[model samples]
Target chain A: MTSTSLNNTVPAPQSTPSYADIQSIVANDFEVMDKQVFGSLNSKVQLVMSVSQHVINAGGKRMRPLITLLCARMFDDNPSEKAMHLAAITEMLHTATLVHDDVIDESGQRRGKPTANATWDNATAVLVGDYLIARAFNLLVGFQSLPLLQVFSDGTCDIAEGEVLQLQHQHNPAATEEDYLRIIDGKTSRLFMMATQGAAILQDKTEYMTALGDFGQHFGNAFQIIDDVLDYSGDSEVMGKNLGDDLAEGKPTLPTIKALELLKDSDTEGYEQLRIAVQTGKTPNAEQLIELVRSSGSLAYCKQRALEETKLAQDALSTLPDNRYRTGLYQLTELASARLV
Target chain B: MTSTSLNNTVPAPQSTPSYADIQSIVANDFEVMDKQVFGSLNSKVQLVMSVSQHVINAGGKRMRPLITLLCARMFDDNPSEKAMHLAAITEMLHTATLVHDDVIDESGQRRGKPTANATWDNATAVLVGDYLIARAFNLLVGFQSLPLLQVFSDGTCDIAEGEVLQLQHQHNPAATEEDYLRIIDGKTSRLFMMATQGAAILQDKTEYMTALGDFGQHFGNAFQIIDDVLDYSGDSEVMGKNLGDDLAEGKPTLPTIKALELLKDSDTEGYEQLRIAVQTGKTPNAEQLIELVRSSGSLAYCKQRALEETKLAQDALSTLPDNRYRTGLYQLTELASARLV
Candidate 1:
């Protein structure tokens, strides 16, 4: 769709591949992982099945599982069924988090579709989310590999802690960049790290764990930073969420945090206004605040930082064998960064 | 405390022990398990630690962990530190469920203490509940026993499914007694079974798993049935909740289900009133509804049924080695049944 360099070091691609193009690299594996996500849900309870299916079906891109699938193949070309199953588990865990996040955010819609909490009551959403988590662990135990269990269980805890850390920082306008990184690292990157390293662990490619983990973490950081940037700059119609939704929710994302820092010295009035908005979650001047952040040059800094993280992620991949799957992953980071342009 | 027969077959004790008295049989184990419940929470996230501590401290009876401690000793007189850790994990899982339950139920207080959802927001409660579940599994993985992971994971899935099943049956007056058993079996009994069987698994005493599982399931059934009975008969102040709270929530527990059946024949007018109340959850004449169920002889039947389950639980214990811990577990069931009188 568009041409961009995969990284500053790599030559510019003739054309940037779309997500579908990247997914097609592992087309058969992607299809199986997608099916297993729904197939693995074996709940005797009718409500559990219905709610779990609704949320999982509403999922976006399947990026985390794609990462898992790609990483599994990078280690072993003919990865076993366990790799596909593990990939499905990653998506299930992701869906579980989204289900609870909707309940927490009191969101009615996600990606133009109604949320589980919106379709059912909060009670159904919460319990079904719990069921998904339990079911994921139950399926993981079927592998009988303690190492696999250890990676997943430990990653899940970090994901939860990351979510809690985000809550702790909510409404605190003074939240620093370090605080933001810690929160996203726990909530966002940890799962990505798990997705990458999990395959290595499953394939008994323990030696590749560190490189895979670094690839995951840096890629995750880039992904979340790009997402935060889009919250300020992307089209509401395209994104299916309003601009400044994070600010209105008092979530101190990078744009708002950096904007606050940039405005503090240059425009004290603008600084106080944004700070109050963050503190009270009162976005009466939502349009004006968006403009202020845009004019403050914060988005440029955020894009630059996202690009830096993307570069580091691609660097980490250099240690692994060069293959189509690695190129797919490289293109993924570029695609995520392309959103910034 | 009131005295009750331990079972129809066993000779009645001179005096039935209270829960505290039964817990005193393994007082040292109970103390360590209690401390470890707090100590095992090693989250760097301040919010996680605070909310986890709040719910754990507000825990009622620590009965599940007590069951675990007692079962551990039944196999090995000198259980290792792992037993205490496992027992603590049981409590953590129990607390995790309670935290989410509060959010689902929108409960303001539990056992006279403010709930995590009530004290913090639902977001914080949901995330921390997740953290606890993950932390429990993470700790379980540390044991490096796939069998232990299998039992805990299976039981956790059942617990969540049971919760969803209860939500499905809510406000449905047509729910049958069988449906009630299935619901409580998942939501209540599964954890009890896990606590008992987990100890046997950890101690390498697979021979006793079936008996221990039966003991835990029946005991959990009796405990839940007795709890339902008390919702109609216990003191509001003493129970820390209003009488007929379950009816208010439109939960068709055994009392409500059985009463609907009995009243349909004895008094058609009374049957319609109860049915409407269950359907609408509009219990304006709450006392009258309580009276209608009481006069229909459902409470007596419930108490009789609870006694039957308690007897079955004691019968399961016949296969296990006779020891003070066995006596302690038997007394624990007696203590639960005593609440009925």
Candidate 2:
């Protein structure tokens, strides 16, 4: 629910550069960052390490860390390992949220992998998630940057608040697009903002903070929006996604929120069915509800919104620097937007 | 399990001081600290506020923060408000752990109050708990003391690891008393250390840290031992505590661990019943098992160990200022040990 399933699995886009291409732009940094994500998890408790390593192994894309790597390179080609370390912290934080999200959603599997909750139990998942978050801050404090700690700590609060906000709106049919924006703003975009802005703070590139924030926020919004739209229209069978998982969880994502808005007057019975599905979370009519959302021109609206966010993200990046790293960020947004087409 | 039920309930002793008596020594700081605990919770999300306030409202005697206030005043009769602020943060961290503990335990009530998990649900409980944790760190960072942040971040990691250690040892009949000590050291005593040491750090009383640490550790150990001892021998019928709840949950507390050791050679059948109960977390013969542990002289041994720890805590206080605050600290340990009598 807190972008737990928002894996950076960019769908087919013949024109845009791929995720691997962007990651390769900072391939060396990514290698170090990937190792540090595992290395930084120093826990005497075997269960903490085992569960953390398992989840980090299955962690999707390392997308946020890659953003940090790219941003660091954008500022200084030979930025200190601090950027890589910070990138790793961002991934750890993201993984922590995902672990808790699985517990909350009672999700057995995520992105074709069994979740920590499935492998162990909700209690293990919850505690391990807590360890990851605590360890992240512990490592962040080692950097001796008050600003770094401030942003990370504040971002963490936003992430939790965003998650709670999503919970508040769960099973709520009246949740608005504004409410959806606010939710993603915290749960999803806030970390993305941290990934880039953290690198800026580390490299003494404080001047670029605002632009990096915009880039991270809009890009995050685009990524999450694309993921939510896929919950309805993606090749769920091939992806192994139980279609309408979000709706079944009564997660009033943008697709559901917008569909309810578009269909409020056009098709009262269809609207009523979708509304009840969200409110009750008894998605006996899951297929029909998904189809109703898909046909209500809601997916089109969401796709367009995702593109607008992508464009805004690219525009924000243009204000940062002109480099292969910046281009990589642009392509990353294009890759996210590519999923819709 | 992670000291979630260590409610700091000081049992009867006419000579030893009462909890209210010790708290009254720092009554002003306690009042300010209490308000800060509620005031510092500034989540804009209504649910975060609602759940956080509910849990904070239900938070027990706030034993840890009282340690902080006393430590601060012992160093400086009028220490800065930072001490009070840090005290509040400790309580916040404690409440956060309790909220998650309820979720992990699937507990409906804790200390005779409906838990956040029971009042709302696990999802809300979990995310709100996360928010409380993040919020605590967020406020801690406001202190601008890197060392303070370092200790807190490190303490938080230890807390989580302690909890995971508890979960790992759960349902294991082979768990040792040493393992029990390590579990409580992290889950229960670590925060106590933080409560005392954090105030010393704030007051620039660097010399007192070692003594404060010793005091916190021993007092915490004594407090937790008394609580576990009560599980087997306390008036469960009147206290609303279900006897053998720890055994039913397969928690390897000192009483169960010691009982297992004591009866293994002396009473094989009784030992096997306790062993099976621990391993399976099923106590069909709960009353008999509680009686066995009680009669095996395990509680007496535990009570003796608790008194020894209480003496060590009082000894630690002798190195610090010998004001009423120090007496408050000494009396606090005496009150805890008095429960054993």
Best prediction by TM-score: 1
iRMS of each prediction in angstroms?
0.4, 0.5
Model 2, residue pairs in steric clash:
none
The sequence of per-residue lDDT tens digits that candidate 2 reaches over residues B155-189 is 99999999999999999999998898899899999
- Winning model by DockQ: 1
Residue B312 lDDT in candidate 1: 88
| Per-residue accuracy of model 1 over A157-207 as CA lDDT, tens digit each | 999999999999999999999999999898899999999998998988999
Over B213-251, each residue of candidate 1 has an lDDT whose tens digit, in order, gives 999999999999999999999988989888999999999
Which pairs clash inside model 1? Answer: none
Tens digits of per-residue lDDT for model 2 on A190-234?
Answer: 999999999999999899999899989999999999999999988
Candidate 2 — what's its lDDT? 0.90
Whole-model lDDT for model 1 versus the true structure?
A: 0.92
